[model samples]
Target chain A: MWSTIGEAGEFGLIARVTAQFPGTGDVILGPGDDAAIVTAPDNRVVATMDLLVEDRHFRRAWSSPEDVGRKAVAQNFADIAAMGARPTALLVGFAAPPDLPLSWADGLTEGLRAECARAGGAVVGGDTVAAETITVAITALGDLGGRPPVRRDGARPGDLIAVTGPLGLSGAGYALLEAGVLGPDDARRLVGDSAGGADPGWAACLREHRRPGPPYAEGPRAVRLGARAMLDVSDGLVQDLGHIARASGVAVDLDSAALVPDPALVEAAALLEQLGAARRAPVEHMLFGGEDHALAAAFPPGTDLPPQWRRIGTAAAPGPEGAVVTVDGAPARAGGWDHFG
Target chain B: MWSTIGEAGEFGLIARVTAQFPGTGDVILGPGDDAAIVTAPDNRVVATMDLLVEDRHFRRAWSSPEDVGRKAVAQNFADIAAMGARPTALLVGFAAPPDLPLSWADGLTEGLRAECARAGGAVVGGDTVAAETITVAITALGDLGGRPPVRRDGARPGDLIAVTGPLGLSGAGYALLEAGVLGPDDARRLVGDSAGGADPGWAACLREHRRPGPPYAEGPRAVRLGARAMLDVSDGLVQDLGHIARASGVAVDLDSAALVPDPALVEAAALLEQLGAARRAPVEHMLFGGEDHALAAAFPPGTDLPPQWRRIGTAAAPGPEGAVVTVDGAPARAGGWDHFG
Candidate 1:
C-alpha cells in the first residue's frame, strides 16, 4: 500500500479509528457527531490531561501498546480520583507513524476501553493524526456527586497523615528492570502481579509501579469522614506529604519506627541488597519513590485510620513560619518525582 | 547542568517545572495538590483534543515552538466553536527532549496563553515529560449555555450550503513555504499579521491557516436560525461538502464561478502559476487544501445566510439523484486533506 494520508482520507480515518471503540451510555453522542455530547452529573466536571510520548513515557521493550494505553487511562483516572470524583469519560487524541500497525492502534484503544471499564467510564471522542511516533493525550472527565472537592490546602495542625496504598514498588521495579537483574518470569511477576504475597511487600510495590490501583472507592469515603485535606500520591510519599504541609501552612513529622516493609517486599529487597546492587533504601524508597497512585491525606487528630489506610505522621503549625517534613525527628531529605527540574 | 533525567530526580523536576506557574482562580488548587479544582459553569463543559508531533505535524525548520503552541490551541478551540460553544479553558501536555532549552518551553506556553486569550479561554492544567521529540496535546473545554448543540447530522434535502470564512490559503501558503519560494516578508504575510488586514479575504484565508479565526460569534446565530448539519471546514471545500452530503444523506453541487477569490491571493497564485512552479491548483487547491477553520452549514431553502457566511450550494437527495459534490454539472474530485492511507 502506498504511504499517503490520501488513501484513508480524513473522514475515513476518523471512522476507522472510532469504529474500534464500543459505546458507553455516558456518551450522549459518540465519535460520529460534530462534537460528542456527555452527561455531566452535578452539572460539573473535573478535567485533567496527560500526554505520553513514545520512548519518553514508556519503551516498547517494557510495555506493549496495550500497556501504554492502560497506563495512560489509569494515570488520568487517578487524577480524577485524587479530586474525590469518579471518572465518567475520556477523550483521547493519538498521533502515530503512518507505518505503524493498525492492530497496535486497535490494541491501544482496547486497552483504553478496558481500563475505563474498570473505572466505570467510557471513551467519548478523539482525534488521530499521522506522526513520527505515538503520542497520546487523554482528557479525563469526572463527576464529583455534589461533594465539595477535597483540596490539598485543608490540612490542619495535629492532622494525621495517612496513605491508602503501598508505595515505592514501581520505582524499584523499574530499577531492577533497568539493571537487568530479573529474568522473563521475574520481570513479568514484578510488573504484572498485584497480589500482596510474592513477598507481599515487593509484589505490592511492583504492582504499585505498574498500574497504581488508586483507592477510588476510598476518596469519597475519606471526604465524608471529614478528611481535612487529601490527595492521591502520584509522587512519592514524603514529597507529597511535603506538598500537604506547604499548602496547609503546617509541618509534618513521620514516625519511621512505625514504618515497616511487608515481609515479601523486604525479602525481595534483601535479595537485591545481597547482590550488592540495591540503590534503594527500603523505607526511603517507599517514602520517596512516587507513581504508587496511593491516597494520602490529613485527618483530624484521633480520627481512626481506615483498614485500607495506614497512619504515618502528624501535621503541626509551620515551625518558625516555614513548613518542614521530618523523618524520625530529623530533617527528611528527598521529596519525590518532578516532571521538570 | 545534568544531561539526562538521571540527574535531577523526576519529583524535583516536577517541582521546579511547576513552581513557575502561579495559581489562578480556576485553579482553586495548584499543581502540588493531588489534583487541581476547576469550576465548571452551568455544570457543563465542552471538551476537544488534538495532538501534534515533530516532523509529522511540524518541522523545526518550518515552525517555532511558539508557533506550534498557538496553532495547537487555535485548532482545538475551533472545534469547540464549531459546536456553538464558548471555550472556557484548556489543558496542555507536552513531551520534549530534556536538552531542549527552557526558553523554548516557556515560549510555547506563552504562545498557548496568547492564543487562548483570543478565544476567551485559559490553560488550566497539563503534564510534561522527557521525550525523543516534541509532542503537544491540547484539550479545550467550552460552555454551550443550555442550547441544543448544533450538530453535523441535521442538514436536509433542499437546504442551502454556506461557509462562514474563506478557504484554502493554508495549503497555498504551505505549498509556497515547502517550495522554498517564500522570502521572509512573504512568509510573514502568509502566516503572520493575523489582524489589521485591509484585504479581508486574504486575511481570512491566511488566518485560516496560521490560527483559524473560527466564526465564534456566528455559531450561536447559526443555531438560532435553524441551521442544519454544521461543521468546521478542516478539509477543503469539496471534501467537506462531501461529508455534509454523506452525513445528511444528500448531494451538494457548487457553482465555482460564484467563488470570488481576494485579489491579492489571485495575484500571488497567478505569479506562481506563470512561472511554471507551484504544483498546487488554485481552484483545486481551494477545493481540497484544508486547515481553513471556516464553518459550513446547510440552511432551509430561502433562509438568509448570516452576514458573515456565503451561500455556496444546495442539498439534494444523494446520487445522480444529484452529483454528491458537482462543480458546474460535473463530479468534483480531490475533496480535501487525508490523515492516513
Candidate 2:
C-alpha cells in the first residue's frame, strides 16, 4: 500500500475525513466552511496545539498508524487537562504523501476517534494536504467552565508538590523498540498488559508512555482545592518541577525515595541491562526523559492529595537565589530536551 | 542570513515570532500555554483553515516572503468571512528547510502581522519544524455573534446572485507578470487598482493575487440582508457561481455582458499576446483562475443588494435533473482548480 504525495491531494483527504465524524450541536458549521463554529458552554475557551512531523516526532517503523494517531490526540488532551479544563473539540491539519493508503489514513482517523472518545472530546474539523512526509498539527479546544486557569507561576514557598501519574515509560518503551528487543506483537502485549494492569505499577508506567491517562478531573479539582501552582510533566519530573520553581522564584526538592513508580521501572531496567540492552544512564533517563504527560502541582500544606495524585516533593523559598530543582538536596544537572540545542 | 533549520529550532523560532505581535484582551492565554484561551463572544467560535506549500501555492522566485505570508493569511481570512463571521485569532504551523534565511522568516512574520491587523485578528499561536520545503497551515478563528452561518446549500431558486468586489483581475495580472512586459517599478505601481477603473489595474490585480481584500465585514452584512447562500470567490466568478448552483440544487444564469471588470483586463491581455505570449484562453483563464478572494452571494429576486454588493446573475429551479450554470443562456463549462481528478 504505497501511495505518492500527489494522488489524494490535501483538500480531497480533508473532505473524506470530515465526512466520517458525525457533528454535535456545538459544531454549528463543520469542516467544509472557512471555519468551524463551536459553541462554548459559557464564554471561556481553552485552546492548545501540538505539531508532529515524520521522522522527527515518530518513525513509521516504531509506531503503527493507529498508535501515531492515538499518541497525537492523547498528548494534546493532557495539556488541556493540565490547565484544569475539560476537553471539548479538536481541529487537525494532516500532511501526507499522496500515495499513502486510504486505509492508513482511515486508521489514523480511527485512532483519533478512540482517544477523543476516551477523553470526552470530539474531532470537529481539520485540513489535509499532500506533502512528501506525514505531519499532524492538532489544536485541542477545551472549556474551563469559568474557572481561573491554573498557572505554573503561582507556586509559593512551603507548598507541597504532587504528581498525578507515572513517568519514564515512553522513553523506556522507545528504547526497547529501538534496540529490536521488542517486536510489534511483544510491544503490544507488554503495553496492553500494562494498561490492563496485570502488573499494576509497571502497567501504569507503560500506559503512561504509550497513551497517557491525563488526570482530567484533577485539573478542576486542584483549582477548587486552591492549588498554588501547576504544570504537566511532559519533560520528566525534575526538569518540569524546575519550571515551576523558576517561575515562582522558589526551589523544589523531590524525595525520589517516595516515588512509587521508581521501583517498578527498576525491574525493567535490570532486565534490559542483563540482556546488554540498557543505555548507560538509567536513573538519569527516568529523571530527565520526557513525554510522560502527567500532572504536577504545588499546594498549601495539609491540603489533601486528590484521589489520583501522589505527593512527590515540596516547594521551598528560594534556596541560594538561583537554585530551582534539587533531587536528594543537590541541584540536578541536565534539564530536559532542548529542541534547538 | 542563512540559518540552519537546526539552529532555528521549532520552539526558538515560535518564541521569536510570537514576541513580535501585540496581544489582545480577549486572549486569556498566550503562546507558552498548552493552548491559548480566547474569549468567544456568543459562546461560539468560528474556525477556518488553509494550507500553502512552497511550489504549489507560491514559488519563491515569483513572490517575496512577505507576499507568501500575506497570501496565506488572506486566503484563510477570506474563508472566515465567507462564513459570515468576524475574524478573531489564528494558529499557524510552519515547516521549512534548515537553510532558509532568518530574514526570510522575519519578513514572512511581518506579512502575517500586516494581514492579521487588517482582518482585526491576532496571531495567537503556532508550531515550526524542519521540512524539505516551506509549508504553512493556518487556522483562523472567527465570531459570528450568534448569527446563523450562511451556507452554500441555502440558495433557493429565484435568488439573484451578487458579488461584493471586482473579479478576474488577478488572472490578468498573473498573465502580465509571466510575460515580463512591465518593469519592476511599473509592476509595483499597478498592484491594487481594479480592472474597470481608469488606472491600469495591474497593481490592484497583482495585489489581489498576492494579498486579497476579503471584504470580511460584508459576510455578516450579506447574512443580515437575507443572503440565502454565500461563498468567497477564490476561484473566478463563473466557476464559483457554479459551485453554488450545484450545492443549492438550482441553475445559475450569469449576464456576461454585465461583467464590469472585463474591460480593465483587456489591455493587459492584449499586451501579453503582442509580446509573443501565446493566445491564452480567456474563458478558460477566467473560469478556472482563483485567489481573487472576492465575496459572492445569492439572494431572493428584488431583495436589496447589500451596500457592498453588486448584481451578477440569477438562480432558477433545478432543471429536470442536474443543476447547471449558464453564461448568457448557454451551458457553462466546468472550470476550477481540483486537487484530485
Candidate 3:
C-alpha cells in the first residue's frame, strides 16, 4: 500500500484518486484528460471558487481530511446554489507536502466524491503539487437550467428579505469546538457531561461546521417564485446582507423578532454559556454567525414566501446614517470572518 | 496608499484586483457575486485547474509577481486548449501571506487580466485567503465550439504523430536562470557577457520561461484537421508522449531527425553551454526538456499535416517490452517532472 504521497508519486497518486469517482450525468468527459467537459445545458456555466489552507482555514487537530475536503466543496457549491443553479462539476487543485500520508489523500478524494455526488456534480479535473502546507482550491460549476442568474443587485426598495436553511449552527458549533466541549473525539465525549451527547442540536452544530448542507434546491425555487436578489450567508448575515443592500442601492432592516433560532440552536448557545464560551447571545449568533450557507433573498413586496423560507427583513430607501443594514431600525455592526482581519 | 495585503483587507483587495479586468464576450456575469455565469454556446464547458505554490512552482526571488501570475494562468489555459476548446472564463483562488505587498498583488492581477484577455476569456469570480505562502489556484473554463474533444486515447496504430509550437525553450531558459547567467537583472546583465543581451534568441528563452505562449488556436485547428489524439507538451516531449502512448495502448516511435530544434532555440542551448549551464545537447533539450506548452497530436496515416504541425513520430503496435514511448527504435526514459518524485 502507498504510505506517503512521496512514495506514490504524482501520477500514481492521481490515478488512484480519480479512479474512485463515478461520472455523473452532466459530465461529458471525466478526469485523466487535459480538461474534462461538463454539460452546461442552459448555454451558460455558473462558476465559483474557494480556498481552504491548512492552519488558516482548517487545522488537522480539529477536522478530518474528509471534513476539509467536504467543507471546501460544500462552500463553493453553495455559491452556485445561491446563483439559482444546480451544481454540475467540481475541479480541485490540491497542494500538500510530499510527506502527507497517501491515506489522507484517499480520504480527501472520497470526501470530494461523496459531496460532489450529493450535490449532483462530478469531479471533473484537478492538478496536484507539493507545497509547504496543504491547500485545497475548489471551483464548482453549475447549470442555471435556463433561468436568468439570480444576482445580489436585483433587490428593490420595499422587497421582503427572506432566508432559508439553518443560520447559526455552524458558528455555535465552532464555539463548542473552541471551548473544548467537542475536541479530537466525536461529540460523544463532552467533558464532564457525557449525557449531553444525546442532544441532536449540539451534534448538528458540530456536523454543520465540518460540512454545511445548503438548500441547493431552494435557490432555483426562489427564482421560480419571483425572488429578485439572493446570496448564501457564507459570511455573517449582517455583512452578507450589507452586500445586497449596497449592490441594490437600498437599506435593509431586519426584524429581529422574526429571526427565531432553532430551539436546539438556542440550546447550543446555552450550552456554550454553560462552558463560559458564549461571547454573544443566541439571537446574535442567528443574526451574525456565518458559514451556515443559508440562502437569503428578497422577494417582491407581498410575494408569498415559500414555507421553507422565513421573511427576516425588508429592503427600503437608504438610511441617512450611511448604514446599509440595520436590525430593528438600528444600525447593526457586521463582524466575524475576514481573511486578512 | 495601500502597502501590504493586510492593510487592504480581503474585500478591498478583491475589489481592487477585479476592477482591472474589462469584461469579455462570453461572460454573462462578472465578479462581486456568489458566482459568475459564463456563456457555453456548445452546451459543454471544458474545465481544468492547476496550482502554483510559492517556492514549489515559482520563486519570487527569480520570478516577478507578474511572471508567476502569467505562468499559472498560461499553464491552465493550455490544458483547455489541449481539449480543443477556446478559453472562456477564469476563476482564481489566491492564498497569500498578509505581509505580501499590495503592489505585488496588483501586478499579479494585471498579469492575469492580460493573459485572460489574450486567451479571450473573462475573469469570472474568485476567493482570496490568507496563507503562509502564496498559492495561485486557477480554474479555466473553455468552449469547445461544438467539436468533440480530442482525447489522448484516440490514437491508433499507424497514426502519424505531429508537433506544433516551439519546444524546450522553457527548459533551456530554466537552465540559464538557474546557472546564474540570467539572474536578478533581466537579460540586461548576462553574468559575464553584456553583448549576449542583444541576442533575441537568448532573450526569447528567458521570456518563454517566465510566460509561455502556447499555440492555443492550433488546438482547435488540429481538431478541425482530424487529429485523433492531442495534448499540450507541458512536461518533456517523451513524458507527455508517454501519456498518449499509454492511453492509446500503442507503442510510439519518434523520428529524432524530424524534431529539428528551432535555430534560435538551438542558439539558446549553445549559449547555455557557453555559460557552462548546458546539461545536455540542444536536441536533448528538445527531447527531455519541458514546459514548452506546445501542442502534440496524432494524425491519420497519409494525412498531410498543416504547415503549423510537423510530423515527428508514428504510433505502432506495442513492443514486447513495457516501454510505451520510444526514440530512434530504443526505449526513451521519461523523466523531468513529478511533484512528489
Candidate 4:
C-alpha cells in the first residue's frame, strides 16, 4: 500500500496523477509546464469555474473520492454545454489534508479523467496543495465552433421550453441517501453488478447522484438546430427557469401534467416510503431539488424539436407581478440550493 | 454596516462583487450566465490554475482579504506570462464560510479586479460557494499572439540563463511575517506612508509577501527576442532552475557573485539581526526563497540581452554526476516550498 500524501510528497503525487491522464491532440502542451497550451480553433472560447468543498458541497461519509471528482468536473462541463459549446479542456486546482490516503487521490484522478473523456475534453493542467479539508475547483474551456453562444437572454415570449436529460433522479437519490435507505458503500457495491440484484430503479438513482450523465452531445445539436436561449438545470427546474425568465424579460409557465419525473425516481420514492422514510413526491423533487445537469433550452415557436428534448413549458410575456415562472397556472415557490443561505 | 455572507445570501453577494467589475471588451459574455465567452483572437490559449487555502497558502491574521485576492490572481497570471503569453481573462472560484463578513468578500473582489487590470485582463466569470474555510482558485487564459511558446525543454548547451524581476523579497518578507516583526495591522498602516516611518525595509517585505508583481510584459519581450526557454521562479531560484535543466537535459552553472540581492532585502536582514531573529543571510534568501514570480529564461549565448533581463548563469553539457544545476563551481542544494511535505 502507498503512504499518505505527506509521506509521498508533492512531486511524487503529481507524477502519479499526471500519469493517469494521457495527452490529447488538442493540447499543445500538457502538465509539467508553467502553463498548458490548448487549441481554441474557433477564435473564441467559453469558460466557467465551479468549487466543491467537503461537507459543504459534498460529504465524505456519503460520497466517495471518485464520486466527488466526477461531480466536480460534470458540473463545470455542464456549464459549457449550456452555452452550446463543445468542451476543449479543463484545468483543476485541488487541495486536501496532508494525511489523506494516496488511494483517495488516485481514485479522484481516475474519476476526473473518465468524466473528461465522456465530455470530449482533456485535463490540460492542474495544481495540487495541502489544506485542512478537501476542495476541488475546476475550470472548463469550450470552443463555440464559429456559432454564436446560446444565452439565457435570447428567449422570447413565444418560445418553447424543453430539456434534454432526465430530471429529479439526483434529488431523489439525495433524499434516499439522507434517509439512510441507500448508503454510498452500497452504491459502490452495486456499481460492479451489471444488473442490480434486487432494485434496479433505486440503484440507478444512486449512480446518477454519484455521477450525473449529462447530454453533452445534445448541446451542439440544439445550437445547430437553432436554439434561441439556453441554460443548465443545476439549481432545480423552477429556480433555474426563473433565471431565464428574468434574463429574457418573460414569464415561463410549465404544464404540471406535461412534466413527468423519471421512472427511477418514482421507484426510488416508493422504496423510501417502504423503508419508513418521509415520502417526498417525485414532482416535488423535480420542482425544488437540484444537481441534475440537464440542459434546458427555449426554441423558437414552431421549430422542430430534437429527439432528445422533451417539451415541458412555454414562455410568455411578463404579467403585473413581473417576469416569473409558474406551474399549472399558479406561482411555484422559488426554492433551491442557496450556498450562503 | 452590511451583514455577513449568510445574511447577504449567495446571489446578493454575487451581485455586489460583479458590480465591482465592469465588463471589459475581451469578455463577450460576463457573469450571471452558465459560462462566460471571451474572444481568443490567436486561435490558441495558454491556461493555468492555482489554489490558495486559508492558513496553508495564506492566513487571515497575516494578510488582508484584498491582499489574498490579489496574490491569487497574480500568481496564476504569472504562470501564463511565464509561457510567453499575454493574459486575456480569468475565471475564479471562491469558497468561504457563510458567516464570513461581506466586507471581506468585497475587498477580495476589488483586489482581483485591480490585479487583472495590471495584467491586462478581466475577470470574465466565477463561482461562489460556502465552505468551512476560505479557498480561492483562479484559472487564467492567455493568447500567444501568433508566437511560439518558450517552453522549458528548448534550451541548448550554449544558452545564457537570465532573469527579469526582483528575487527573494517575498521569502525575506515571509521570514519577517513568521517572526511577527511586522503584523498585518502594521503593514496596512505602512501602505499609506511614503517615508521610512519606523521600518521601511520590513514594510517592503510585508508588501511583497502579500502581493507579487511579476514582469508580465517581459515574457513576450523575451519570446520576441529569440529566447530559447523560459519559466517563472516560483519555488526558489535554484529549485525552479532545476526544472529547466532537467527538461532541457543540460547542466546549468550559476555565477553566485553575479547574483545581486535587493537593497530592501539587505535592510530587512539587518533589522532581523537587530531583533535577534534567526540570522539568514540576504544572499541565502536570494538563492533559496521562493514566490517572487520572477521570469527566468535562457537566451542564445552572445545575444543582446534586454535591459530588464540580468545575466545570471550559463547552460552546459550535463555533468558526469548527472546533476543538473550548480553554483560557484559547486552543487547548489535544491530546496523550496513543498506543499504536501
Task: Report the lDDT of model 3 for residue A297.
Answer: 97
RMSD of each: 4.8, 4.4, 2.2, 3.4
Per-residue C-alpha lDDT of model 3 across residues A1-341, encoded as one tens digit per residue = 77999999998988987897768889889998999999989999999999989888787877888888788888989999999999988998889889999989998998887787778887878989999899999999999998888999999999999999998888888887788756424444544454264555567788888888888889889999898999999888998999999898999999989988887687778777666665778778887888989999999999987699999999998868653899999878878788998
Of the candidates shown, which would achieve the greatest DockQ relative to the real structure? 3
Q: What is the lDDT of candidate 3?
A: 0.86
Candidate 4 at A326: error in angstroms? 1.3
TM-score of chain B of 2: 0.89
Alpha-carbon lDDT, every model: 0.70, 0.73, 0.86, 0.85
Interface RMSD of 4: 0.9
The residue pairs that clash in candidate 4, if any, are: none
Q: Is the docking of candidate 2 incorrect, acceptable, medium or high quality?
A: acceptable
Q: What is the lDDT of residue B166 in candidate 2?
A: 58
Question: How much is the lDDT of residue B312 in candidate 1?
Answer: 75
Docking class of 4: high
**lDDT score of residue A148 within candidate 1:** 79
- Give the candidates in order of DockQ, highest first: 3, 4, 1, 2
